[model samples]
Target chain A: MTDHDHDHHHDHSELSELELRVRALETVLTEKGYVEPAALDAIIQAYETKIGPHNGAQVVAKAWTDPAFKKALLDDASKAVGTLGHVGRTGDHLVAVENTPQRHNMVVCTLCSCYPWEMLGLPPVWYKAAPYRTRAVKDPRGVLADFGISLPKETEIRVWDSTAETRFLVLPMRPAGTEGWSEQQLADLVTRDSMIGTGFPKTPGAPS
Target chain B: MNGVHDMGGMDGFGKVEPEPNEPVFHETWEGRVMAMTRAMGAAGAFNIDVSRFYRESLPPTVYMTSSYYKKWFLALQDSLIARGYINDAEVKQGHAAAPAKDLKRGPFKLDDVKRVMTRGSFARAAEAPAKFKPGDRVRAKNINPVTHTRLPRYVRGHVGTIERHHGVHVFPDTAAKDAGEHPTWLYTVVFDGAELWGPDADPTVKVSIDAFEPYLEPA
Candidate 1:
């Protein structure tokens, strides 16, 4: 590992040292019949488009519109989410926490990036960075402030640290004036960060 | 282990920088690494816990300096070599020193890639019934083993209440070491902010973690 670091510093070339190493590794593995390029492309395509935050948005939209679904979701997220065809990988046992008028919920993985990849796709870079891991638990309000979200002074914050297998999804409170809105319209208001409890749903007239 | 990866309550890392309109993969190499790692994993090269342990075992300097996928690449190389899929000489030379040996299950193919990415096997299995239930007072064990652990350092030795029972799941510590699944009861434990971060912490804040049965004791 140190040798690679030394090589990285001495080689001031167009390609980054990390990129060069990855390219070389891929070359050797592919040449030796250990990896298939087509297989690699297929995996990338699936994650890029076939699966992502849209699945979570659909779940959130259903919860907002159907009180029965909301009750079922808060009761057993893994089972309720499965009803929407969103069940697999890292989402095997999910728990849904609701954000009500009195309390707000946020999710963080302090040990490692254990997110609901099946629902929300790969976590954003900031979610895996050190600062968010440390500060999210120590100063959650301050962290929310950094994300430009400020709750009412009297509202309580509940930070969920994903330490084990069970993953968490925060059901953000529905925005006002969206009454009788279609599920499709409500799904548009639901953002990835809102489901993670970093921000709120978009207002009705607000630009996406 | 009390590795540097446990950054629950440490300081001096810096502010969280949210990049606007970030691409799924920042560079071509990152995408390649992600795909390769997942492919290798699908081939039964190693389990998720073992992969995480390899990343956690890196030196702090290397772990901190490398980007996210870069770390994945490093861990992949180390795991592949350790499991006899590749060797140091071949890795250094960037070519096959000899023809690859026959794999029992065969390498992953393009036709199955999508299915592999979408399906996942559950690690949970039936175990002894849960010792505690929701509203039960419990305390985290103060342990710092030099092995993979799901228990975070900040919550160790602190008292919390059992919020929910998540049922039995594979214990990561033993699984990372190639041991049996050792499934145990899991629960969501909620700690008062003041108990974990001192009285200075906001009294209204509460922190919850999903802890395995072995990491908790009746308070």
Candidate 2:
């Protein structure tokens, strides 16, 4: 399998028909002066590089290493994340849910795609898809299994349905054998899926 | 109104397929749509709730057929027309019939994009004291208005406990109607999985929803 396949499950050979339609629509809108190309690039660049999953990874790593920061994150995620310079978009009222040995947390926006964009960036394709939206709440374990995550049988799963203004971020447990690791090292272990509660953080010495 | 967007307990959509090495966006058009939606939003063409209502109001077939960005494109088209930014003729003909009207400000500049995105309006305002507090029993009202609403149909009329108050924020039901913010207390309500999905659900799973106060009543 290719490196891409190893990262995620699905593959698309070419752009779909809907994508072509959107292209045409965009061209028309741009020509009509309703959208500015430079502005588009700016917005895309901000989410793509400057503000994304890495921000959340840093937040997770800090929470794992610092007890007081973890308490602040759990108490008022919006204000705590702001202290780390991550704030905006659906992140005004943030709530950090910690995943302990006994309770696992997962996030899904059933009504709409209300993600913590400033911290986690734009949500992944699956997070916005219909199946994940419905199944995450209905069959939590089954959904986790699809993502190759299997929690202990006794662990209680709490699915946070982001129906209103508050956005959720799942604080995954720190992996074993990384006790003395620095925050930067721990940040590298935190993956995008871990914060979303679809997968776990990378184990120490494991191939990323 | 039970819109197609409310896909909580319903079935038949199939599996959640994660795209391999998915870029921030799939294609150029998708990126454009995302940018346009935000730029237009910044331009004050429409509020977030109105934009959401546009997507929710789409025909079920169209709603299902369109991709995420495609829906945004379609909704942006509707918003542009409704807000007098563009007309149906211009959309169909692929060209503007007349010069676009001069606005107080132009589309977002590249320099201000970062600041605009990071510094979004909170929209939360001080209102009356919350009717319910943490650990209070409440039931989601079953009212299904044809216009925009944040309450999902699956949780309607269901009893759940208020986990915590989320402070007062804009109520989408009135926001979409262009009435006002109609700020209300929001809460995170937790319901037992069995309570929501009946006996077939796994008792170990619990579902929590961020519910606005108007959607809830003392149970």
Candidate 3:
């Protein structure tokens, strides 16, 4: 009925632009004795921190120095990550994929962001997007190449689907010439990309 | 065996290339709803008695229309509403109505919740079943018209063998069930890409998917 209301409605029909619409609709529904808006708001907020993908570099660093610990990690990630103070939720049954000159590892969740949240933290935007999920499986080399992450032709990309129960971590190859580096130093060489099985683990003082 | 999020290299058809464009950037009420959900969990509101709601009442459309978190959220809301933490009418109420009300719940008496969260880590640790032996050849069942299944689309109807019987793991299908939410029989099956995709794959490129028992048949 009002010019202002007409302009506001015309300017935005999409949900992203008009979250107020959700609130408005919730009000109308609730006032008419139908819906409860606060519960919906609470639920959505809980997941916003779910920005997907966390740091992989740190996990790679710990693996380079610890063998027995690494064995435990590969055996069962939930408990193994406890060695580094990362546990619970996503780590229930952990598996560490290896990336070597002969084989490489990558991760994707085609349906949703089923990532190893505790170990890797939140997943990166690209890691959870549909493009990476579909393309990485189709042309693994092409997608990695675009990210400036190329392995030799002989290398194999072992893509993993991270699930809510079972989690994944990439065991990146240790960089050369770091004969005496500490675990922390080695951890620094690992990256989020390497953990996702895209980029190679960085060499200390070596170019990425 | 089958992890909920292990979807990898099937075919390159579903990618939303170049992404989308031309939308004003703002958080939706959906986001606001998600935010409040977290806060409620933080505030210790609601008596959320979660018991794996995936086995019975899993909505058919949820298979494709929802994200993992959305699945989880739906699962949470379903169980909650079913038990009366909030009703359908409550869900319809606008934001800010259900703020830290007098609804007192939660058994978290003295100690922190850190201990309870580890319940999954210690379930049947040694009591779990380990049936299939590794290195045994088996044929994956020819599951057709699979509207709701975790078995990868690429590996179905293909022949592979039990690579490793990684003990008894939780069955997501069952865990996701509304009535019975518990883990089921799980095993890892190693399928050579040549067997799955034929000449398109290198012979050495073998993919091993940890599959639940329902998806297998004896070779």
Candidate 4:
């Protein structure tokens, strides 16, 4: 592929519903033929990959209790994350973004939806589209608001747009008041958005 | 050509209207196609194992989002190139060798394909020396050199905080190099909006990024 094909540097704009409909129709028509088999097996194998939803939750739960581990996670993720046993594929060089009270982070692979699927599980359908890519950069506030997350004006918002070369995964801050929560209790606080840096991990016994 | 990221601002478009769910039509066709293709692969297709993995694990976003045929075609290309079955040049050649496919269902040929499928490019990368360490504050280089690079354009020249020190690994850019080059040191660089977008950026906005050793200098 040409270098431009995989680059995720440019600002993304929105796509109307009509384009999506047309895209769907085109996709359906293209599928009406005898397909190649290796491709099928490849798709199957990717899903069967060890980096699924379960692995991502464990990373969050571990971070909740172990401050030293969190420091390690921030210092050298690929090796540090290994302490929690999540590696391989996309995460060999994992980068974990922390969302604190004054700052929030969000990740989107604008070019090709290059996600940390292994650690975060499957991505939402909208993530692969162009609108989310363009609008996310141009109007971070608006996009976050749609997801019902509006950062305070005093707080800063940074969007990490992933490209073909690098992928991103979020490491949510340990919530307050859950000083002695179990692993399962911590896992419950992790949401898909938190892993992507859109929403904060719900604090234990906090609002839904 | 339109910029690759211009999916939005696609003209005076309206809201995404909902359509009736057509899961069956999708499943039956995509399933049949994938199965038949995999069977063809079993017959006399290209490298079977590598093909199998690439086909299955391609960017699911692309597979589901792009035109169905585009996804299949690209997936095939990625596998071919990845396994060195064909390079860009070979692909450009248009006429490549037939896979060492065993006669259909004669017997599974796992060993033969294994070598090609699992080839690693670790030997080609040039390992980083000195450079920087963890907690280093570096500004990403703004270089726009035209070579194979893993550094994204948006992140170039931005200032960031180095989060981790991932041990050197193979650099995918020089992967085609027949000789050796150890992988470079890679780290995360966080950038503030004012740093990337100036006045337009929010005062408090901060964006962190991954920076290869070459893409950074001491800030």
Candidate with the greatest TM-score versus the true structure? 1
Give me the displacement of residue B66 in model 2, in angstroms: 1.5
Q: Per-residue CA lDDT of candidate 2, range A94-201, in tens?
A: 789999999999999987798888778888878887889889889989889888779888889999998876778999999999989999999999988999889899
Q: Which candidate is the best by DockQ?
A: 1
* Worst ten in a row by lDDT for model 4 chain B: B16-25
Q: Tens-digit lDDT track for model 3 on A102-203?
A: 887776655455566555544554555445765664566767776776666666666554423455677878888999898767766776667777766666
lDDT of each: 0.84, 0.81, 0.53, 0.53
For model 3, residues B1-219, the per-residue Cα lDDT tens digits are: 233333456454343332222111122543543433333343344312232223114555553344433444455455545645455655555433443223233322223223322324413233445556777777777664323345666676888878555555655554443334355556767776678667877544555666777778777
Name the lDDT value of residue B36 in candidate 2.
Answer: 78
Judged by TM-score relative to the true structure, which candidate is superior, 1 or 3? 1
Model 2, runs deviating above 4 Å: A1-34, A85-91, B99-106
Compared with the true structure, what per-residue lDDT tens digits does model 4 show for residues A1-208? 1111232333447433323332333232223222233444444444445435556767768776788877887666655766653433333556676777777778866444557755765454456544565566546676676567677788777777653234566877777888778988888888777788766778666677
Candidate 4 on B23-125: residue-level lDDT in tens? 2113223333433334334433443323433433555555434534245456655653554434454444333333422333332233232222222222224
TM-score of each: 0.93, 0.91, 0.68, 0.61
Q: What C-alpha root-mean-square deviation, in Å, does candidate 2 show against the real structure?
A: 3.9
Clashing pairs in 2: none
- Candidate 1's C-alpha runs over 4 A off are A1-13, A85-91, B99-105, B119-123
